[model samples]
Target chain A: MKGRSRGKVVARFGLLAALALILSWLESLVPAFFAAPGMKLGLTNLVVLVALYRMGDRAALGVNLLRILLAALLFGNGYSLAYSLAGGLLSGAAMILLKRCGRFHMTAVSVAGGLMHNVGQILTAMLLLDTWQLAGYLPVLWIGGMAAGLIIGLLGAELTRRLPPELFD
Target chain B: MEAKRKRFGRNDLLLVAGLLLLGVALTLALGVNRRDGREVVVRVDGEIVARLSLSEERELPIEIDGRIANRLQIADGAVRMIEADCPDKLCVRKGAVRYVGDGIVCLPHRVVVEVAGEDELGLDAVAG
Candidate 1:
Protein backbone atom coordinates (compact mmCIF):
# COMPACT_ATOMS: atom_id res chain seq x y z
CA MET A 1 0.00 0.00 0.00
CA LYS A 2 2.81 2.40 0.89
CA GLY A 3 4.67 1.83 -2.37
CA ARG A 4 1.48 2.15 -4.35
CA SER A 5 0.58 5.45 -2.69
CA ARG A 6 4.09 6.77 -3.30
CA GLY A 7 3.67 5.91 -6.93
CA LYS A 8 0.39 7.78 -6.96
CA VAL A 9 2.09 10.86 -5.51
CA VAL A 10 4.77 10.77 -8.16
CA ALA A 11 2.16 10.28 -10.82
CA ARG A 12 0.17 13.19 -9.49
CA PHE A 13 3.22 15.39 -9.62
CA GLY A 14 3.88 14.43 -13.21
CA LEU A 15 0.33 15.13 -14.31
CA LEU A 16 0.13 18.47 -12.58
CA ALA A 17 3.57 19.50 -13.81
CA ALA A 18 2.63 18.70 -17.38
CA LEU A 19 -0.59 20.65 -17.09
CA ALA A 20 1.40 23.64 -15.77
CA LEU A 21 3.89 23.51 -18.64
CA ILE A 22 1.07 23.42 -21.18
CA LEU A 23 -0.53 26.40 -19.55
CA SER A 24 2.78 28.28 -19.64
CA TRP A 25 3.09 27.55 -23.31
CA LEU A 26 -0.45 28.66 -23.96
CA GLU A 27 0.18 31.94 -22.15
CA SER A 28 3.35 32.58 -24.19
CA LEU A 29 1.50 32.13 -27.45
CA VAL A 30 -0.74 35.06 -26.64
CA PRO A 31 1.08 38.18 -27.73
CA ALA A 32 2.02 40.70 -25.07
CA PHE A 33 -1.39 42.11 -24.11
CA PHE A 34 -0.25 44.79 -21.72
CA ALA A 35 2.48 47.36 -22.04
CA ALA A 36 3.67 46.59 -18.55
CA PRO A 37 6.95 44.72 -18.68
CA GLY A 38 6.94 41.26 -17.03
CA MET A 39 3.17 41.23 -16.72
CA LYS A 40 1.82 37.73 -17.28
CA LEU A 41 -1.46 35.92 -16.96
CA GLY A 42 0.37 33.43 -14.73
CA LEU A 43 -1.89 30.65 -15.99
CA THR A 44 0.37 27.99 -14.46
CA ASN A 45 -0.74 29.10 -11.02
CA LEU A 46 -4.00 27.31 -11.72
CA VAL A 47 -2.22 23.97 -11.52
CA VAL A 48 -0.19 24.98 -8.51
CA LEU A 49 -3.20 26.32 -6.63
CA VAL A 50 -5.19 23.19 -7.29
CA ALA A 51 -2.28 21.07 -6.09
CA LEU A 52 -1.87 23.14 -2.94
CA TYR A 53 -5.46 22.66 -1.80
CA ARG A 54 -5.83 19.08 -2.97
CA MET A 55 -2.41 17.45 -2.41
CA GLY A 56 -0.74 19.92 -0.03
CA ASP A 57 2.47 22.01 -0.16
CA ARG A 58 4.99 19.32 -1.04
CA ALA A 59 2.86 18.32 -3.99
CA ALA A 60 2.24 21.89 -5.09
CA LEU A 61 5.87 22.91 -4.72
CA GLY A 62 6.99 19.84 -6.66
CA VAL A 63 4.67 20.75 -9.51
CA ASN A 64 5.64 24.44 -9.45
CA LEU A 65 9.40 23.85 -9.45
CA LEU A 66 9.17 21.18 -12.11
CA ARG A 67 7.11 23.40 -14.37
CA ILE A 68 9.46 26.37 -13.95
CA LEU A 69 12.58 24.34 -14.76
CA LEU A 70 11.05 22.56 -17.74
CA ALA A 71 9.53 25.71 -19.18
CA ALA A 72 12.75 27.67 -18.75
CA LEU A 73 14.74 24.99 -20.52
CA LEU A 74 12.27 24.75 -23.36
CA PHE A 75 11.21 28.40 -23.74
CA GLY A 76 13.28 30.67 -21.48
CA ASN A 77 16.87 31.32 -20.37
CA GLY A 78 19.11 31.43 -17.29
CA TYR A 79 17.99 34.88 -16.20
CA SER A 80 14.38 33.81 -16.66
CA LEU A 81 15.16 30.74 -14.55
CA ALA A 82 16.36 32.92 -11.70
CA TYR A 83 13.39 35.25 -12.07
CA SER A 84 10.86 32.43 -12.14
CA LEU A 85 12.49 30.68 -9.21
CA ALA A 86 12.33 33.78 -7.08
CA GLY A 87 8.69 34.33 -7.95
CA GLY A 88 7.72 30.67 -7.60
CA LEU A 89 9.47 30.13 -4.29
CA LEU A 90 8.17 33.26 -2.69
CA SER A 91 4.62 32.77 -3.98
CA GLY A 92 4.66 29.14 -2.86
CA ALA A 93 5.78 30.14 0.61
CA ALA A 94 3.03 32.74 0.88
CA MET A 95 0.31 30.39 -0.33
CA ILE A 96 1.45 27.62 2.02
CA LEU A 97 1.46 29.95 4.97
CA LEU A 98 -1.92 31.39 4.11
CA LYS A 99 -3.49 27.98 3.64
CA ARG A 100 -2.03 26.76 6.92
CA CYS A 101 -3.73 29.61 8.74
CA GLY A 102 -7.13 28.08 7.86
CA ARG A 103 -8.77 31.48 8.18
CA PHE A 104 -8.81 32.59 4.58
CA HIS A 105 -10.42 31.31 1.39
CA MET A 106 -8.47 29.81 -1.48
CA THR A 107 -9.07 33.02 -3.39
CA ALA A 108 -7.30 35.02 -0.70
CA VAL A 109 -4.37 32.66 -0.65
CA SER A 110 -4.06 32.72 -4.41
CA VAL A 111 -4.33 36.48 -4.55
CA ALA A 112 -1.54 36.83 -2.05
CA GLY A 113 0.43 34.33 -4.05
CA GLY A 114 0.00 36.38 -7.20
CA LEU A 115 1.02 39.65 -5.58
CA MET A 116 4.05 38.17 -3.87
CA HIS A 117 5.13 36.42 -7.02
CA ASN A 118 5.53 39.72 -8.88
CA VAL A 119 7.13 41.29 -5.83
CA GLY A 120 9.67 38.48 -5.73
CA GLN A 121 10.50 38.82 -9.41
CA ILE A 122 10.90 42.58 -9.19
CA LEU A 123 13.02 42.26 -6.07
CA THR A 124 15.25 39.74 -7.82
CA ALA A 125 15.66 42.15 -10.73
CA MET A 126 16.50 45.01 -8.40
CA LEU A 127 19.05 42.99 -6.48
CA LEU A 128 20.59 41.44 -9.57
CA LEU A 129 21.05 44.81 -11.26
CA ASP A 130 21.37 46.91 -8.08
CA THR A 131 18.69 49.49 -8.83
CA TRP A 132 15.90 50.89 -6.70
CA GLN A 133 14.17 52.57 -9.62
CA LEU A 134 12.27 49.39 -10.35
CA ALA A 135 10.05 50.16 -7.41
CA GLY A 136 8.22 52.61 -9.65
CA TYR A 137 7.25 49.76 -11.91
CA LEU A 138 5.84 47.82 -8.96
CA PRO A 139 2.51 49.63 -8.81
CA VAL A 140 1.64 48.74 -12.38
CA LEU A 141 2.57 45.11 -11.84
CA TRP A 142 0.71 45.04 -8.56
CA ILE A 143 -2.55 46.13 -10.17
CA GLY A 144 -2.11 43.77 -13.09
CA GLY A 145 -1.14 40.95 -10.77
CA MET A 146 -4.19 41.61 -8.66
CA ALA A 147 -6.51 41.44 -11.66
CA ALA A 148 -4.99 38.18 -12.89
CA GLY A 149 -4.94 36.76 -9.37
CA LEU A 150 -8.63 37.41 -8.88
CA ILE A 151 -9.46 35.40 -11.96
CA ILE A 152 -7.04 32.62 -11.07
CA GLY A 153 -8.21 32.50 -7.48
CA LEU A 154 -11.85 32.18 -8.54
CA LEU A 155 -10.97 29.31 -10.84
CA GLY A 156 -8.76 27.70 -8.21
CA ALA A 157 -11.54 27.81 -5.67
CA GLU A 158 -13.74 25.91 -8.08
CA LEU A 159 -11.02 23.42 -8.97
CA THR A 160 -10.25 22.58 -5.36
CA ARG A 161 -13.91 21.86 -4.84
CA ARG A 162 -14.11 19.40 -7.73
CA LEU A 163 -10.88 17.57 -6.82
CA PRO A 164 -10.85 15.65 -3.58
CA PRO A 165 -7.76 15.59 -1.38
CA GLU A 166 -5.39 12.74 -2.23
CA LEU A 167 -4.25 10.02 0.21
CA PHE A 168 -0.78 11.44 0.96
CA ASP A 169 -2.15 14.01 3.45
CA MET B 1 -11.70 34.77 12.05
CA GLU B 2 -14.38 33.66 9.65
CA ALA B 3 -13.34 30.07 9.20
CA LYS B 4 -16.65 29.08 7.62
CA ARG B 5 -16.70 31.90 5.09
CA LYS B 6 -17.52 31.12 1.49
CA ARG B 7 -15.05 31.60 -1.33
CA PHE B 8 -14.52 35.24 -2.33
CA GLY B 9 -16.93 36.37 0.33
CA ARG B 10 -16.90 39.51 2.40
CA ASN B 11 -13.47 38.71 3.81
CA ASP B 12 -11.97 38.00 0.43
CA LEU B 13 -13.56 41.08 -1.08
CA LEU B 14 -12.18 43.16 1.74
CA LEU B 15 -8.71 41.74 1.21
CA VAL B 16 -8.84 42.46 -2.49
CA ALA B 17 -10.01 45.98 -1.86
CA GLY B 18 -7.22 46.50 0.64
CA LEU B 19 -4.59 45.26 -1.79
CA LEU B 20 -5.93 47.49 -4.54
CA LEU B 21 -5.79 50.43 -2.19
CA LEU B 22 -2.21 49.63 -1.32
CA GLY B 23 -1.29 49.53 -4.98
CA VAL B 24 -2.94 52.88 -5.63
CA ALA B 25 -1.31 54.50 -2.61
CA LEU B 26 2.09 53.23 -3.70
CA THR B 27 1.51 54.59 -7.16
CA LEU B 28 0.76 58.06 -5.88
CA ALA B 29 3.67 58.14 -3.43
CA LEU B 30 6.29 56.77 -5.79
CA GLY B 31 4.98 58.61 -8.84
CA VAL B 32 4.87 62.08 -7.34
CA ASN B 33 8.59 62.56 -7.63
CA ARG B 34 8.95 61.28 -11.14
CA ARG B 35 9.16 63.69 -14.04
CA ASP B 36 10.42 63.70 -17.62
CA GLY B 37 14.21 63.90 -17.55
CA ARG B 38 16.77 65.54 -19.83
CA GLU B 39 19.20 62.62 -20.10
CA VAL B 40 19.38 58.86 -19.96
CA VAL B 41 21.85 57.09 -17.72
CA VAL B 42 23.16 53.70 -18.79
CA ARG B 43 24.55 51.22 -16.36
CA VAL B 44 26.37 47.98 -17.01
CA ASP B 45 26.65 45.46 -14.20
CA GLY B 46 25.66 48.07 -11.60
CA GLU B 47 28.16 50.71 -12.77
CA ILE B 48 27.38 53.89 -14.67
CA VAL B 49 28.66 53.51 -18.25
CA ALA B 50 27.23 56.55 -20.00
CA ARG B 51 24.97 59.55 -19.47
CA LEU B 52 23.55 60.69 -22.78
CA SER B 53 21.32 63.71 -23.24
CA LEU B 54 17.85 62.91 -24.52
CA SER B 55 17.86 66.03 -26.70
CA GLU B 56 20.47 64.38 -28.91
CA GLU B 57 19.50 61.82 -31.56
CA ARG B 58 21.92 58.94 -31.56
CA GLU B 59 22.19 55.19 -31.23
CA LEU B 60 24.51 53.44 -28.80
CA PRO B 61 25.35 49.76 -28.59
CA ILE B 62 25.72 48.42 -25.08
CA GLU B 63 28.69 46.05 -25.29
CA ILE B 64 29.41 43.23 -22.92
CA ASP B 65 32.70 41.37 -23.46
CA GLY B 66 33.27 43.28 -26.72
CA ARG B 67 29.97 41.96 -28.04
CA ILE B 68 26.98 44.26 -28.54
CA ALA B 69 24.27 43.02 -26.20
CA ASN B 70 21.64 45.71 -26.80
CA ARG B 71 21.16 48.68 -29.14
CA LEU B 72 19.80 51.79 -27.38
CA GLN B 73 18.23 54.62 -29.33
CA ILE B 74 17.52 58.11 -28.07
CA ALA B 75 14.97 60.31 -29.89
CA ASP B 76 12.03 62.62 -29.14
CA GLY B 77 13.27 63.00 -25.55
CA ALA B 78 12.72 59.30 -24.91
CA VAL B 79 14.92 56.19 -24.90
CA ARG B 80 14.13 52.75 -26.25
CA MET B 81 16.04 49.52 -26.70
CA ILE B 82 15.78 48.88 -30.42
CA GLU B 83 17.54 45.53 -30.29
CA ALA B 84 18.72 42.96 -27.79
CA ASP B 85 20.43 39.58 -28.10
CA CYS B 86 18.78 38.31 -24.94
CA PRO B 87 16.29 35.49 -25.23
CA ASP B 88 13.20 37.32 -23.94
CA LYS B 89 13.73 40.66 -25.72
CA LEU B 90 11.78 42.21 -22.84
CA CYS B 91 13.97 45.30 -22.81
CA VAL B 92 13.08 46.02 -26.38
CA ARG B 93 9.45 45.42 -25.67
CA LYS B 94 9.49 47.75 -22.70
CA GLY B 95 9.33 50.54 -25.31
CA ALA B 96 10.56 54.00 -24.39
CA VAL B 97 11.28 55.51 -20.98
CA ARG B 98 11.31 59.27 -20.46
CA TYR B 99 10.45 59.70 -16.80
CA VAL B 100 13.12 60.07 -14.18
CA GLY B 101 12.31 56.80 -12.46
CA ASP B 102 11.52 54.82 -15.62
CA GLY B 103 14.08 52.17 -16.60
CA ILE B 104 14.63 49.56 -19.27
CA VAL B 105 16.39 46.50 -17.90
CA CYS B 106 17.93 43.60 -19.82
CA LEU B 107 18.46 41.05 -17.10
CA PRO B 108 20.57 38.67 -19.21
CA HIS B 109 23.03 41.41 -20.11
CA ARG B 110 22.82 43.16 -16.73
CA VAL B 111 22.15 46.45 -18.48
CA VAL B 112 19.94 49.25 -17.11
CA VAL B 113 18.99 52.50 -18.85
CA GLU B 114 17.20 55.17 -16.84
CA VAL B 115 16.32 58.81 -17.21
CA ALA B 116 17.94 61.44 -15.00
CA GLY B 117 17.54 65.17 -14.69
CA GLU B 118 18.28 67.97 -12.22
CA ASP B 119 15.31 66.64 -10.30
CA GLU B 120 17.17 63.36 -10.05
CA LEU B 121 18.02 64.79 -6.65
CA GLY B 122 14.43 64.02 -5.76
CA LEU B 123 15.29 60.34 -6.06
CA ASP B 124 17.76 60.52 -3.20
CA ALA B 125 15.37 62.55 -1.10
CA VAL B 126 12.55 60.11 -1.75
CA ALA B 127 14.78 57.15 -0.93
CA GLY B 128 16.04 58.86 2.19
Candidate 2:
Protein backbone atom coordinates (compact mmCIF):
# COMPACT_ATOMS: atom_id res chain seq x y z
CA MET A 1 0.00 0.00 0.00
CA LYS A 2 2.83 2.41 0.86
CA GLY A 3 4.60 1.80 -2.42
CA ARG A 4 1.41 2.20 -4.41
CA SER A 5 0.58 5.49 -2.70
CA ARG A 6 4.09 6.77 -3.38
CA GLY A 7 3.73 5.90 -7.04
CA LYS A 8 0.34 7.60 -7.13
CA VAL A 9 1.89 10.75 -5.64
CA VAL A 10 4.60 10.79 -8.26
CA ALA A 11 2.13 10.33 -11.08
CA ARG A 12 -0.09 13.08 -9.78
CA PHE A 13 2.82 15.51 -9.55
CA GLY A 14 3.93 14.55 -13.02
CA LEU A 15 0.49 15.22 -14.45
CA LEU A 16 0.33 18.60 -12.72
CA ALA A 17 3.74 19.53 -14.05
CA ALA A 18 2.70 18.60 -17.57
CA LEU A 19 -0.44 20.67 -17.26
CA ALA A 20 1.64 23.63 -16.07
CA LEU A 21 4.00 23.36 -19.03
CA ILE A 22 1.14 23.26 -21.50
CA LEU A 23 -0.52 26.22 -19.87
CA SER A 24 2.74 28.19 -20.00
CA TRP A 25 3.05 27.41 -23.67
CA LEU A 26 -0.51 28.46 -24.34
CA GLU A 27 0.08 31.74 -22.54
CA SER A 28 3.07 32.40 -24.72
CA LEU A 29 1.07 31.77 -27.88
CA VAL A 30 -1.55 34.34 -26.98
CA PRO A 31 -0.81 37.94 -27.87
CA ALA A 32 -0.21 40.03 -24.82
CA PHE A 33 -3.18 42.31 -24.18
CA PHE A 34 -1.27 44.39 -21.67
CA ALA A 35 1.28 47.06 -22.54
CA ALA A 36 3.99 45.78 -20.23
CA PRO A 37 6.70 43.61 -21.75
CA GLY A 38 6.69 40.80 -19.18
CA MET A 39 3.02 40.72 -18.29
CA LYS A 40 1.44 37.26 -18.37
CA LEU A 41 -1.78 35.65 -17.31
CA GLY A 42 0.20 33.25 -15.12
CA LEU A 43 -1.89 30.27 -16.18
CA THR A 44 0.64 27.80 -14.78
CA ASN A 45 0.07 29.22 -11.33
CA LEU A 46 -3.40 27.73 -11.27
CA VAL A 47 -1.83 24.29 -11.39
CA VAL A 48 0.59 25.18 -8.63
CA LEU A 49 -2.27 26.38 -6.46
CA VAL A 50 -4.17 23.16 -7.11
CA ALA A 51 -1.15 21.12 -6.15
CA LEU A 52 -0.66 23.15 -3.01
CA TYR A 53 -4.20 22.47 -1.87
CA ARG A 54 -4.74 18.93 -3.10
CA MET A 55 -1.35 17.26 -2.64
CA GLY A 56 0.94 19.32 -0.36
CA ASP A 57 3.51 22.09 -0.29
CA ARG A 58 6.33 19.83 -1.40
CA ALA A 59 4.34 18.63 -4.37
CA ALA A 60 3.35 22.16 -5.27
CA LEU A 61 6.96 23.35 -5.04
CA GLY A 62 8.13 20.39 -7.07
CA VAL A 63 5.57 21.03 -9.79
CA ASN A 64 6.29 24.75 -9.85
CA LEU A 65 10.07 24.34 -10.12
CA LEU A 66 9.83 21.56 -12.67
CA ARG A 67 7.36 23.49 -14.78
CA ILE A 68 9.57 26.61 -14.74
CA LEU A 69 12.73 24.76 -15.72
CA LEU A 70 10.97 22.77 -18.41
CA ALA A 71 9.21 25.78 -19.84
CA ALA A 72 12.39 27.85 -19.76
CA LEU A 73 14.34 25.17 -21.57
CA LEU A 74 11.63 24.91 -24.19
CA PHE A 75 10.58 28.51 -24.88
CA GLY A 76 12.59 31.00 -22.79
CA ASN A 77 16.15 32.26 -22.37
CA GLY A 78 18.46 32.47 -19.37
CA TYR A 79 17.19 35.95 -18.43
CA SER A 80 13.58 34.88 -18.57
CA LEU A 81 14.45 31.80 -16.55
CA ALA A 82 15.88 34.02 -13.80
CA TYR A 83 12.79 36.20 -13.74
CA SER A 84 10.33 33.31 -13.72
CA LEU A 85 12.25 31.38 -11.09
CA ALA A 86 12.35 34.35 -8.76
CA GLY A 87 8.67 35.13 -9.30
CA GLY A 88 7.49 31.53 -9.02
CA LEU A 89 9.43 30.75 -5.85
CA LEU A 90 8.42 33.97 -4.13
CA SER A 91 4.78 33.61 -5.16
CA GLY A 92 4.71 29.98 -4.02
CA ALA A 93 6.14 30.93 -0.63
CA ALA A 94 3.61 33.71 -0.24
CA MET A 95 0.70 31.42 -1.10
CA ILE A 96 1.87 28.73 1.29
CA LEU A 97 2.20 31.15 4.16
CA LEU A 98 -1.16 32.78 3.46
CA LYS A 99 -2.84 29.39 3.18
CA ARG A 100 -1.34 28.35 6.50
CA CYS A 101 -2.70 31.46 8.18
CA GLY A 102 -6.22 30.13 7.56
CA ARG A 103 -7.69 33.60 7.71
CA PHE A 104 -8.12 33.96 3.96
CA HIS A 105 -9.41 31.70 1.22
CA MET A 106 -7.59 30.54 -1.87
CA THR A 107 -8.80 33.64 -3.74
CA ALA A 108 -7.14 36.05 -1.35
CA VAL A 109 -4.04 33.93 -1.10
CA SER A 110 -3.77 33.77 -4.86
CA VAL A 111 -4.16 37.53 -5.14
CA ALA A 112 -1.28 38.09 -2.78
CA GLY A 113 0.70 35.48 -4.65
CA GLY A 114 0.14 37.30 -7.91
CA LEU A 115 1.21 40.65 -6.51
CA MET A 116 4.31 39.15 -4.96
CA HIS A 117 5.16 37.46 -8.23
CA ASN A 118 5.30 40.82 -10.02
CA VAL A 119 7.28 42.30 -7.17
CA GLY A 120 9.79 39.48 -7.43
CA GLN A 121 10.17 39.95 -11.18
CA ILE A 122 10.66 43.67 -10.83
CA LEU A 123 13.27 43.15 -8.17
CA THR A 124 15.05 40.72 -10.44
CA ALA A 125 15.00 43.26 -13.25
CA MET A 126 16.35 45.97 -10.99
CA LEU A 127 19.09 43.68 -9.74
CA LEU A 128 20.12 42.61 -13.22
CA LEU A 129 20.04 46.09 -14.78
CA ASP A 130 21.53 47.75 -11.73
CA THR A 131 18.97 50.55 -11.78
CA TRP A 132 15.68 51.37 -10.13
CA GLN A 133 14.17 53.02 -13.21
CA LEU A 134 12.20 49.85 -13.88
CA ALA A 135 10.41 50.41 -10.62
CA GLY A 136 8.22 52.96 -12.39
CA TYR A 137 6.49 50.06 -14.07
CA LEU A 138 5.46 48.50 -10.77
CA PRO A 139 2.11 50.20 -10.22
CA VAL A 140 0.82 49.24 -13.62
CA LEU A 141 2.11 45.71 -13.20
CA TRP A 142 0.61 45.55 -9.74
CA ILE A 143 -2.83 46.42 -11.02
CA GLY A 144 -2.52 43.89 -13.81
CA GLY A 145 -1.32 41.20 -11.41
CA MET A 146 -4.19 41.79 -9.01
CA ALA A 147 -6.75 41.58 -11.80
CA ALA A 148 -5.23 38.38 -13.16
CA GLY A 149 -5.02 36.95 -9.65
CA LEU A 150 -8.67 37.67 -8.98
CA ILE A 151 -9.67 35.86 -12.14
CA ILE A 152 -7.34 32.91 -11.50
CA GLY A 153 -8.42 32.71 -7.89
CA LEU A 154 -12.07 32.62 -8.80
CA LEU A 155 -11.36 29.91 -11.34
CA GLY A 156 -9.38 27.98 -8.75
CA ALA A 157 -12.29 28.16 -6.34
CA GLU A 158 -14.67 26.84 -8.99
CA LEU A 159 -12.25 24.05 -9.90
CA THR A 160 -11.79 23.01 -6.30
CA ARG A 161 -15.55 22.92 -5.84
CA ARG A 162 -16.19 20.73 -8.89
CA LEU A 163 -13.35 18.25 -8.45
CA PRO A 164 -13.93 15.05 -6.49
CA PRO A 165 -12.96 15.58 -2.87
CA GLU A 166 -11.30 12.18 -2.71
CA LEU A 167 -8.65 13.38 -5.17
CA PHE A 168 -7.55 16.05 -2.75
CA ASP A 169 -7.44 13.61 0.15
CA MET B 1 -6.23 19.18 7.65
CA GLU B 2 -9.73 20.06 8.73
CA ALA B 3 -8.81 23.71 8.80
CA LYS B 4 -7.93 23.53 5.11
CA ARG B 5 -11.43 22.52 4.23
CA LYS B 6 -12.99 25.81 5.11
CA ARG B 7 -14.61 27.76 2.30
CA PHE B 8 -14.38 31.43 1.32
CA GLY B 9 -15.87 33.71 3.95
CA ARG B 10 -16.37 37.33 5.00
CA ASN B 11 -12.72 37.94 5.81
CA ASP B 12 -11.74 36.84 2.34
CA LEU B 13 -14.24 39.19 0.80
CA LEU B 14 -12.89 42.05 2.89
CA LEU B 15 -9.33 41.26 1.91
CA VAL B 16 -10.17 41.23 -1.79
CA ALA B 17 -12.11 44.45 -1.51
CA GLY B 18 -9.26 46.16 0.32
CA LEU B 19 -6.78 45.11 -2.32
CA LEU B 20 -9.02 46.28 -5.11
CA LEU B 21 -9.36 49.67 -3.51
CA LEU B 22 -5.61 49.93 -3.05
CA GLY B 23 -4.98 49.03 -6.66
CA VAL B 24 -7.39 51.65 -7.95
CA ALA B 25 -6.01 54.29 -5.64
CA LEU B 26 -2.45 53.69 -6.78
CA THR B 27 -3.45 53.80 -10.42
CA LEU B 28 -5.31 57.04 -10.00
CA ALA B 29 -2.55 58.64 -7.98
CA LEU B 30 0.05 57.77 -10.57
CA GLY B 31 -2.06 58.84 -13.48
CA VAL B 32 -3.12 62.14 -12.03
CA ASN B 33 0.40 63.19 -11.13
CA ARG B 34 2.01 62.34 -14.46
CA ARG B 35 3.50 65.31 -16.35
CA ASP B 36 5.52 65.61 -19.50
CA GLY B 37 9.20 65.15 -18.83
CA ARG B 38 11.71 67.80 -19.92
CA GLU B 39 14.68 65.61 -20.86
CA VAL B 40 15.41 62.07 -21.95
CA VAL B 41 18.29 60.22 -20.29
CA VAL B 42 19.83 57.15 -21.84
CA ARG B 43 21.85 54.80 -19.67
CA VAL B 44 23.84 51.63 -20.30
CA ASP B 45 24.92 49.44 -17.41
CA GLY B 46 23.53 52.10 -15.05
CA GLU B 47 25.87 54.80 -16.30
CA ILE B 48 24.41 57.92 -17.86
CA VAL B 49 25.50 57.88 -21.48
CA ALA B 50 23.44 60.74 -22.93
CA ARG B 51 20.87 63.33 -21.89
CA LEU B 52 18.85 65.27 -24.44
CA SER B 53 15.98 67.71 -24.24
CA LEU B 54 12.64 66.33 -25.36
CA SER B 55 11.86 69.70 -26.96
CA GLU B 56 14.37 68.87 -29.71
CA GLU B 57 13.40 66.25 -32.25
CA ARG B 58 16.27 63.93 -33.16
CA GLU B 59 17.34 60.31 -33.39
CA LEU B 60 20.19 59.11 -31.17
CA PRO B 61 21.93 55.80 -31.75
CA ILE B 62 22.69 54.10 -28.44
CA GLU B 63 25.93 52.14 -28.36
CA ILE B 64 26.79 49.73 -25.58
CA ASP B 65 30.23 48.12 -25.27
CA GLY B 66 31.19 49.80 -28.57
CA ARG B 67 28.27 48.30 -30.51
CA ILE B 68 25.12 50.10 -31.63
CA ALA B 69 22.27 48.35 -29.79
CA ASN B 70 19.34 50.76 -29.86
CA ARG B 71 18.05 53.97 -31.44
CA LEU B 72 16.22 56.57 -29.41
CA GLN B 73 13.91 58.96 -31.23
CA ILE B 74 12.46 62.07 -29.66
CA ALA B 75 9.72 63.81 -31.63
CA ASP B 76 6.67 65.92 -30.81
CA GLY B 77 7.85 66.30 -27.22
CA ALA B 78 7.85 62.52 -26.66
CA VAL B 79 10.61 59.94 -26.57
CA ARG B 80 10.57 56.40 -27.95
CA MET B 81 12.82 53.56 -28.95
CA ILE B 82 12.40 53.44 -32.72
CA GLU B 83 14.90 50.63 -33.24
CA ALA B 84 16.69 47.95 -31.28
CA ASP B 85 18.91 45.04 -32.29
CA CYS B 86 17.47 42.81 -29.55
CA PRO B 87 15.64 39.67 -30.52
CA ASP B 88 12.26 40.61 -29.02
CA LYS B 89 12.23 44.31 -30.01
CA LEU B 90 10.14 44.94 -26.92
CA CYS B 91 11.73 48.31 -26.32
CA VAL B 92 10.70 49.50 -29.76
CA ARG B 93 7.21 48.17 -29.24
CA LYS B 94 6.82 50.05 -25.98
CA GLY B 95 5.94 53.13 -28.06
CA ALA B 96 6.37 56.74 -27.05
CA VAL B 97 6.79 57.73 -23.42
CA ARG B 98 6.17 61.40 -22.51
CA TYR B 99 5.63 61.48 -18.81
CA VAL B 100 8.30 62.22 -16.22
CA GLY B 101 8.53 58.70 -14.84
CA ASP B 102 7.94 56.83 -18.10
CA GLY B 103 10.79 54.58 -19.29
CA ILE B 104 11.75 52.05 -21.94
CA VAL B 105 14.00 49.16 -20.99
CA CYS B 106 15.69 46.62 -23.23
CA LEU B 107 16.53 43.74 -20.95
CA PRO B 108 18.76 41.90 -23.41
CA HIS B 109 20.99 44.90 -23.98
CA ARG B 110 20.72 46.20 -20.42
CA VAL B 111 19.79 49.60 -21.82
CA VAL B 112 17.34 52.02 -20.27
CA VAL B 113 15.95 55.25 -21.76
CA GLU B 114 14.12 57.25 -19.11
CA VAL B 115 12.57 60.71 -18.94
CA ALA B 116 13.98 63.11 -16.39
CA GLY B 117 13.89 66.64 -14.91
CA GLU B 118 11.09 68.83 -13.49
CA ASP B 119 7.57 67.50 -12.87
CA GLU B 120 9.15 64.40 -11.36
CA LEU B 121 6.73 62.77 -8.98
CA GLY B 122 9.30 60.67 -7.11
CA LEU B 123 7.26 57.51 -7.55
CA ASP B 124 10.23 55.24 -8.24
CA ALA B 125 12.01 56.18 -5.05
CA VAL B 126 8.89 55.61 -3.00
CA ALA B 127 8.00 52.33 -4.66
CA GLY B 128 11.54 50.95 -5.00
Cα lDDT tens digits for candidate 1, A4-62: 56667677678889999999999978766575567897999999998887777898999
Tens-digit per-residue lDDT, B1-128, candidate 1: 22434676666677778888888898898889767888888989888888899999999999998999899999999999999987678889888889877888876688988888876645634753
lDDT of 1 at B94: 85
TM-score of each: 0.83, 0.83
Task: Please give, for residues A26-124, the per-residue lDDT of candidate 2 as tens digits.
Answer: 998886556676788899889988888777789889999999999999999998899999999999999999888879888888988888898899899
**The 10-residue segment with the lowest total lDDT in model 2 chain A:** A1-10
- For candidate 1, the chain B TM-score comes to 0.85
DockQ of each candidate, alpha-carbon based: 0.46, 0.45
Global lDDT scores for all candidate models: 0.84, 0.83
The residue pairs found clashing in candidate 1 are none
Scored against the true structure, residue A28 in model 1 reaches a CA lDDT of 78
What is the lDDT for B28 in model 2? 75
- Residue A133 in candidate 2 has what lDDT? 68
Model 1 achieves a DockQ score of: 0.46
